[model samples]
Target chain A: MNSIHDMGGMHGFGRVEREVNEPVFHAPWEGRVMALYRALGFLQFWTIDGGRAAIESLPPQTYLTASYYARWLMGLERSLARSGIVGADEIAAGRSLRPARSHPHIMTASDVANLQRGNFERPTASPARFKPGERVRTLNLNPETHTRLPRYARDKEGLVEAVHGCHVFPDTAAIGAGENPQWLYTVVFTGRQLWGADADPTLSVSIEAFEPYLAPV
Target chain B: MGDDHKHDHEHPDHSQLGEMQARVRALESILTEKGYVDRSTLDLIVDTYETKVGPRNGARIVARSWTDPEFKARLLSDATAAANSLGFPNPVGAHLIAVENTPQTHNLVVCTLCSCYPWEVLGLPPVWYKSAPYRSRAVIEPRAVLAEFGVELPENTRIRVWDSTAETRFLVLPMRPPGTEGWSEQRLADLVTRDSMIGAGLVRGP
Candidate 1:
């Protein structure tokens, strides 16, 4: 249990607190690469116009397949070709491809960072905070947007026996919400605490939690 | 490396994406039918990572620390081994250091590096966690960031920021929320939020 909570407290590369005005940290080519990838991928998690604009803004590159989205598409095309299934080129040649059918590009590390950093904006403050040792309940539902609680962790309860300092809310960042939420918490729960017969009586699983996902039990 | 995803058609119809998804879906369906990828197993993977992994892991650890002092000491000393005892796997040689989120101080997490996370316990990290701004800015201006999320800390509370990297990770032992006295562990897991585990949020009131 301690180990799991400790996992949440992960911090390395801790020394560089603020970005320096160094060229190495960010380069113009980096932005161009991002734009090229976005164009090739047809970015998702964004509106259609936004996606179009991103693609149009891309810097020139000789090959589309080299870009992130194009690479993924290349995989799909191969799968279709191998399966002896319907082909994308036929549809494209016919000019009958639907916008809704397009899959958004799988965001790369750099692209994910760029999108979250520039576009997202957060609210002024947190709506609530649980105190140390207070009781709380985690929500069971799943929202496609960003959330900290995984499906396996749901409906399991633990004591908010300890509080870690605040960090950015993952949900906000996931949906271009920018940084949100301040504190992350560790709740103590036993194995029998979650699965009765399936779990070892003496064994347990500790979970790291965020505030918004939890409610008083 | 490959360019087969595109269709080389005789006419300029331009309906490539629709055909692409349909083809992909068809392949997925075939794989599921052929038993290459078990549907239930994939669903379970998605389910476990999305839910069962986060705050519950944190809570159990905190309980152990509060109840068993020796185990707590061992956990503090060598986190990976301590976690492995509970059937957790550590691939990154992740050395964990647990920070007790107490009334006076709160411990938080961010990856100043790539989105290094404790997947053994927390499962795959949420998409937001892997972002650059969250990784880069989390350590520098934690207070303002917290405020934006609706969590405003008392100025006196000491803020301990954890930087997640490939070599090490951190988890928060959230201070319990108030209300019920005798709720079972299963009941408690209900309140453990992914945010709480990272030190961004406290369990909300029911």
Candidate 2:
């Protein structure tokens, strides 16, 4: 997430400041659509036990109605099974573990931005923002929230990295009071920088940091 | 909104997106039978979303990450707003997250819970991304899984796997590979493959 392009323009990354933005209102509906799609996706997990075990695990009659995802899963399995990604014996034995990040379709950057700007409160523009090459530090607080400083990002201080303009505060999102942030940034931290001693000396990593999430070093 | 669908008994969801599409299609069919809504123009919106808008969106994101540090900074903050900040229009999500990758730990994203992704920047995720193997294994044993993809990190590299819940989504800023100095933003954008930005894989050196 180093640059704006990576987020799918202004509308998609869940941020938008229009006075009457549409997503904030329709998000829940979309959330439902998303839920249905996800339910379809989750059934893939049970496919491991093969169709029978999965069907058996569900309520007696639920199988008739709840069979959509499992069927999709089985089809995928059968297709892969023939290719030897998983053999037919595995299907019969119900022991098929496939590769990671391998599925049927992916959401693109634009897809994400389409969800932006439904009901989030916009942050007032603030001139105080970080810039590339400035020094900064991650915050120490950890509440149940949308925090930019991961457990890993915490306790480690690095350069200001890149001040990525602005955005709605994720803290807002966590509290159901999501306010769009006004600016964004990317901070470069060496793996050695984040994890001292054990960190790979030659390896360096950059972290995307939001304005409210950082302070001057 | 009423006649676009012919009411296919199969794939009910295709008809679920309001009757407008179905109605439009129905009208198109009638028009075509009676000579109206030319075949080329009939799928205007559909074609635009698939071919014109989708890839163009990809080009914008790929181009920006390579050229401007300032823009990159804005992106890292509020992913959605950053695009708007730089003048791009509506993207998909209500929330955006930017995950950074470093030498010691590579950042990859997965929605173990769902298909939460930052589509605006990364374009479409490949088919395999939504698979259970990537989501479940990535959080549990990311090192081994990444290895299969040929991205074998050293044992010491602490893999911090993110399981994106429905509320939060993620995008990755892959490290710019070496030896690509003096390249244009378009050139740099070419390296921004779907997986690398998602943390499932990295864009390799040219």
In model 2, the Cα lDDT at residue A120 comes to 33
Candidate 2 per-residue C-alpha lDDT over A1-217 given as tens digits, one digit per residue, 9 for 90 to 100: 1111111111211111112212211222222222222222232322221322222234323322322333333334343343344455544544333332334333333333343323332454777567677778877666533344444555568776444344555545433453556465656565566656764454444455566667788
Error in Å for residue A31 of model 1: 28
Candidate 2: give the TM-score of chain A. Answer: 0.44
Off by over 4 Å in 2: A1-217, B1-49, B52-59, B85-89
How badly does each model clash, as a count of residue pairs? 126, 89
lDDT of 2 at B194: 59
lDDT string, candidate 1, B60-111, tens digits? 5554544456776777766656665655322323356566677787777775
After superposition on all CA atoms, what RMSD does each candidate show versus the true structure? 21.4, 17.5
Give candidate 1 misplaced runs (Cα > 4 Å).
Answer: A1-217, B1-55, B63-71, B87-94, B178-187, B204-206
Q: Can you write out model 2's per-residue Cα lDDT over B93-143, one digit (the tens) per residue?
A: 556666667777677666543344565544434434543345334443455
Question: What lDDT tens digits, residue by residue, belong to model 1 across residues A1-217?
Answer: 1111112223332222122222210222222322332332333334322232232223323122232333333433343333333246532343222223334343344332222112221333654478778777667756544354544456767667555555556556544555654566766555455556654343333455777667788
Q: Which of the numbered candidates is closest to the native, going by highest TM-score?
A: 2
Task: Give TM-scores of the second chain, every candidate.
Answer: 0.65, 0.69
